[model samples]
Target: MFRLAAVVAAVTVMATAVVAQTDVVAERKSVMRESGKYFYGALPRMLRGEAPYDQATVDAAFTAFADSAKKIPGLYPESSKNAPRTSDYSASPKIWENKADFEAKVAAYGKSIEAARPKATSLDGLKEAHALVRAGCDSCHDSYRVRH
Candidate 1:
């Protein structure tokens, strides 16, 4: 009975560690999806003139984007940089290998969001803001993400 209890405890501890590791991925994925909602969804619609430039959606999307940017540095811990991704895309090991560069990129993302938020007031402004925001995302992905 003691042996069995020890085995169960061991399994529980292992499972808990696994869950904690994946939790970071899950949290980042949630934030990414929220950011994508505008980049892939609402913004595209507006760009194509399928929908009007809805300031409300723009506000919500970029706000979420900025908020998520703030969370990026925390999300990409050393352990998480190369953990088996919950999805097809995973963060590259470069993040850990070049920690300073990765962190600088994350800071740039936050700055991009900050520079873009006020531009949400007008369509042309939003278009520019969207471009800047996407540039930051793309730049980071090129350097530190494996999207396959």
Candidate 2:
């Protein structure tokens, strides 16, 4: 029957959308986690001298962080504001309510990344850049995301 076919098609479409949305959440988390591995993991180890201070690694990490920054705004589509399957930060409703402000925060985050990457060529440089990156993340988290 046409009605049965229509129902099946509708269900398939909705299921596809849900899968896509879940993938978006996974991707967004992956991007952030990639940066975190650099920021919180590698950078600290280098700072403490627990790991060798490799300028190349520092530069690469910051560059990667900046690359992830470019992908930030795109990752946060309206549909991504809710993903029941993901343990990602429950992004605040403020992102949807005042999208302009949300976008402005993202711009600021990018600016910080730009400032941080170049400064990451040496240990002192990397430390300074790390501070800026931390400040930038704190600012955005304070406004746009809910901590759990």
Best model number under TM-score: 2
TM-score of 2: 0.92
Model 2 lDDT-worst window of ten: 80-89
Which digits, one per residue and each the tens of the lDDT, describe model 2 over residues 42-138?
9999888799889877877877778877888888788866777456466787888888887888788889989877877777887898999998888
TM-scores of the models, in the given order?
A: 0.90, 0.92
In candidate 1 the C-alpha lDDT for residue 5 amounts to 100
The clash count for each model shown is 0, 0
CA lDDT of each candidate?
0.86, 0.83
CA lDDT of 84 in candidate 2? 78
How do the residues 65-134 of candidate 1 rate in per-residue lDDT, one tens digit apiece? 9888888888877766556757878888888889999888888988999998898788899888989899
Residue 103's lDDT within candidate 1 is 86
